[model samples]
Target: MNAIAAPAAADDNGLETGLNATLREPISADGTPVLGKTYTVPARHGRAVRVKAGQTIRIANPHGTQVCDTWIFNAEHLNEFLSFEHTRAYIDRIIPQPGDPLVTNHRRPIAELVADTSPGVHDTLMAACDLYRYRNLGVEGYHDNCADNLRLALKAIGLRTREVPQPFNLWMNIPVKPDYSVEWLPPVSKAGDYVDIKAAIDCVVVMSACPQDIIPINALNPLDVEFTVLDPAVSSHS
Candidate 1:
């Protein structure tokens, strides 16, 4: 592994790596923030960050309660999108673990999970919050949702709503009960909990600071989250 260009990745520590039960944190060192900037996504808004090949983006729940609905795309190819179905097909488990690649529709790996500190509670089965969903749920009026936020954020890059693919809910806790039905649950991620993904190829990452207040997904409230893009090329090995 190119330690100078790529931090410890999933290939270095396999998915079976366990987290300390008392306190979970980032997989590898936070490293030096060199290549990109850190963006604070305020509540009810979305943001996009682009990174080159081999860079790592760390999405963190600073408050430990907010969920970030995230989507990925190949910067050069619009047709290829993030496909949870294919990702599930590649792994034996539904929830991502360290070393799992977030694959594109063609099964191309764009990002791989290098480390996570939230007790492995993420949801790949649910769709982003949308107005239609709110309306169906008997919401009184228009409400903020992750879907629209994602579209608004992607617009800056010339992608339309149709191209905004399904998201990977980071730090979300949606569990399936024994009845085979799913239920929204509060996240277990504490403050400073984060998940790091090493970009295998150049890709655009879109995230909604999840405005899901109607459910317990965000603990019935929405808050801000933090995004950090780490350039391993300038980082020193420990």
Candidate 2:
């Protein structure tokens, strides 16, 4: 599948800029409330929604430094498509410096590293935070994380959580150093800068606005995020 590269101007120094806002919706803690086709993502967390080909999903880091890891999967086949290993391999193979298109396992374009909105880019090598990782990180008491949200999203679609893999973290900044070491940095996204994706196929997109307060990533405070869908005509051209 042909992938359109997200322009470097869009994501200057991992900072969100030049994003035009069209709509805003609130996500509650219980879950994303249904508002027609729009989904509300609660504060300090994330959610996933299904989008058909030709549809577009727009996510905003309503509160800066809100890290959201996303994943796209074929709704029909469900077993194949965006694989984390493949995505990492692709990124490693190309060694994208900045402003590169991230491809899925099927070679389908998933997302472009359009805007970083942070001084440090999040790790593509590190998987999503799970119970195991949380415990290892000395935050065993924390039960809720991006992994839990993904599991819930899978259940919402009548799919098993185990079937899902680690998702791509959007807006989160974990920069790689010259020595190839990774470090988590504070978010560079402001109140409104958003990351937009146009679907290439009928797929389920999942995200978790990271709730980890132990680090500086969220400024030690979790805040709400917004999700919206734009008309194809507008989103594609805008």
Which runs in model 2 stand beyond 4 Å of their true positions? 1-38, 88-101, 110-123, 140-142, 233-237
Predicted structure with the largest lDDT when compared to the true one? 1
Model 2, 120-207: lDDT tens digits are 3444555666555657778534445565556555554454333446566665667778998877777766776666666667766776
Residue-level lDDT tens digits of model 1 in 27-67: 12221233656667777777766767888888889999999
Tell me how candidate 2 scores on lDDT: 0.56
Question: How far in Å is the alpha carbon of 76 misplaced in model 1?
Answer: 0.6
TM-score of each: 0.81, 0.71
Residue 54's C-alpha lDDT in candidate 1?
87
Model 2, position 152: C-alpha lDDT score: 56
Clashes of 1: 0
